[model samples]
Target: MLGQPAQLLEREPYISFLSSSALVIKQWLLFDPMPESDARFLLVDLRQRLPVVSMNDGASFHIADGEPAVASDPAYDGSQPTLIPGQLVPTPVWDDRAGSCNWDAKAVLEVTLADCPPVSDERVRAAMELYVTSQYDFLPRSLYLAMLTVLDGLATGSKRADRIAKWIDEKVSEAEEFNDQSLLDGLRGLKNGSHAAGIRALVKRAVLYLGGSEQEAARQANTVKRLYRVRSQLSHQSDTVELDLARATQLTRLVLNAVVSNPALLNDDAGEEASLAGGRERRTQWIAEAEVAIRRAKPDCAAVEKAIRRPLIMGKNGLLIAHLADRTQWAIDDGGARPVSDEMASEWAALDESFGERL
Candidate 1:
């Protein structure tokens, strides 16, 4: 067992060294203090077994064990050495006889804090609203211009109705020109061509069916011509197209009404009542039927929304009716708006039934 004071002295080398140096100066003697009883016993046993010798300098005398006095000159001063505070001392050479000595110091510190929880429901709702707005409003507007160009092509038949029909036939024939390997590449090349041909065919058919009066045919033909001009400017001249939604809506209604009014266009029987009605009832019925069909299709809401939201849909070629339909659908869906309900569906079915089973 080691006493507390002895343990402190043994543990703190700086304090021990200072105390020993002070005692050597005052008493002119060396003292080795052992903290543990076992260490003291070993020291005493070693001293008893070893030989001791005395050496004298001019000022003081000292004893050493085992080793011979290498320097015994009286000229050596043995007075207390001056101690400089905080000065580093040179390390002594390692001696195998001294055995092993080691010193170590270690410390550790720790801290803890509470964790945070997740976000609230209100924030989630806000984020969803923002997502819907961007999809419906922003994305659709960007796509509207492309839609207009397609519509312009489809509407091109009113002016050059005859030429447009021939064009469609020719383009469809061109579609057959591609080999299996080149089909995709050839089809891509025929994009504008195919659209033009389709417009032509639509126009030719419209003209043939409605051309009984030259004046009426000419008016319809003029509309087709204007649409074609728009298409050409968009496709070849790099002209900017601005679709006037109001005008487009009016034109679409007119064309749809005309197509529906003329039962002869579809080879329906010219009944006395149909003749007496002067196509007015037929045109109204056609419009109603088309509206029902569109609702039934329930096209993409984004496409529909884009068309409705914008005053003018700009494109490279012109307005695209199909693209408008696409944008409208997008907008509707994005806004969380459902299409016509079950009631509307039932009503449309009844209307269709009144029109005839063929419709």
Candidate 2:
């Protein structure tokens, strides 16, 4: 899989392999005994790109190398050229229907892969793998767990862990100093200030550290608390439960993007180490600088809105009727409807309600 033809762009500590086509993993092997040995896998990416035609009745056909061409077609002006092997290559289609000949759901990812920065931190990479898996994994329980795992891994820092450890040590010392055995009982089975408080703190800190406004951080921290409750319900009550996958996915991406775009944020441990060495102010200074750097990297919303506001389409009653000359040919090629009526609006409202119910 690593040896396949791909755009291998190397950055310090990591490399990204961007493929123009989808690569399906056929087989894989794990070297458990020899941990240092390289892992091996087989990928199935290369294929003959064939022309396919789909009818309105849902019937479809693909023209391969051995297939005969329709010679006497009314749509043709001249003799049709013979389709030999390797004459055409598969390209991404915008269709969303499953089992369609040109179904490429990862098309957006493919287009953005080249622009994505290479992850400098291994933990962030691991969290990103989990995030991607959560996108496709259909099991609600698994998806919820995977996203929460990412939060647990990246949201919490070494300083918080160290503080918790110190609190535990303090409790032990108080028990010894006062000869209170009940305090020792309180210490038993206690971890990280009761899971709820610990997790909420982690989420709050992570959001603020990533340049999110205080209100936004508090709002997301509240969201995590709700998710944690759902997690508990899933573990203790039943195998299945109602979950908000969208919210979980959004929070996961937020943290992952912040770290990937600014790898310096992942260097929180350096601050923790310095604080332990009696330079506590350095950690505070480092965090301020990191937040400023990340904010600078973020896109300007006003500029983005101005750029995208092109006079590309002609609209009627808030519906796009036709493309203007400024619109790209690709946008004009697709056939669609711009239904603008009272009945259409009613039906759209119904659809929106149904989608909200699902979420």
Candidate 3:
């Protein structure tokens, strides 16, 4: 869309026009709140490049560069949030300094959460390592790949991404029909984010990790699914594509952080495929066991986790701990770093009732 930059000056009437009978300099001097010193500076500039349009009806005007004009009925900020002050976003990246050619540059990314958890430094580091410079094509998938590592690692422990696990099962169970052996192999490689269902599962899991409810996670999954759809267009479609890259990067960062910090979700294979006959019972029982364990453990790491940037500390038995902003202890999954017994689930379940009391 071609922006009407020529009419910008007319639209932004910050300057005051004082009319008079003659085209004399006195008419320009009588402008509202126009200091003589400031008017002289503007007058000098105007003489150099006379405006193309006629001030036939009006005498002259002076542009006030000092104070910003804020109207009582000013426009709303925007749909998105920005931390930067008075951030100006140019319509196009290459807009020039001239008002007719360009506009101001705005902040790159914006993220919002009810309780904004500290960003995961390790994940960022890992992503930065994989992130290709200057090329946009490989980065999104690379970011997704990093998140998938956490998802694949946490897949066994989650009750959330049941749909993704089921999708994986379906793909594997009937691979011949769709030439999906490669897809199956991809799943085997722990890169389950090759499809929409897997991506949704990862999204739901990430939401759950960030202290969100299942319903909320499901809702956010829709957004993740939509993101993947746009991502798909980049690879699959022929037409011109425009994506909200900043939003995508922010979201990917959020998801990657969730997965990185909560790797305990990776060790369990509760979401693995099962036969219709006996598998359903086992799956239900597994879910019930997980729920019972969760109720007993009552993990409060999220409540104390207000750290701006907590350095991950390795504790006894491969357990990771990060001291929160409130000086409370926030624990990471010990089993996540290494293989632990399935019976550890029972012990982990008993963690709330017995372990903390002993300590």
Against the true structure, whose lDDT is highest? Answer: 2
Kindly give the number of clashing pairs for every candidate.
Answer: 34, 0, 5
lDDT score, candidate 3, position 185: 83
Per-residue lDDT tens digits of candidate 3, residues 1-359? 01111212112113323222222221111122334455444334433222100111011222323323332332323221111223332232122233321222111001111112222344333442233221223345554544334333323322335676777667676765777667768665443434456556665655544433355456656766666666567678888666655445444544544444443332224212111222234334433433333334554322332211111111112233333333433333523222234465344434321012111
Query: What's the TM-score of every candidate structure?
Result: 0.22, 0.41, 0.29
- TM-score, prediction 2: 0.41
Better of 1 and 3 by TM-score: 3
- Candidate order by TM-score, decreasing, is 2, 3, 1
RMSD of 3: 22.9
Q: In terms of TM-score, how similar is model 1 to the real structure?
A: 0.22
Ranking by lDDT: 2, 3, 1
Looking at model 2, which ten-residue stretch has the lowest summed lDDT? 305-314
Query: Candidate 1's residue-wise lDDT over 230-322, tens digit each?
Result: 645656776567543333333332332233334333222332233325434333433343344445556422323112111111111111121
Clashing pairs in 3: 153-266, 154-265, 154-266, 156-268, 156-269
Clash-forming residue pairs, model 2: none
Q: Give the 10-residue window scoring lowest on summed lDDT in candidate 1.
A: 105-114
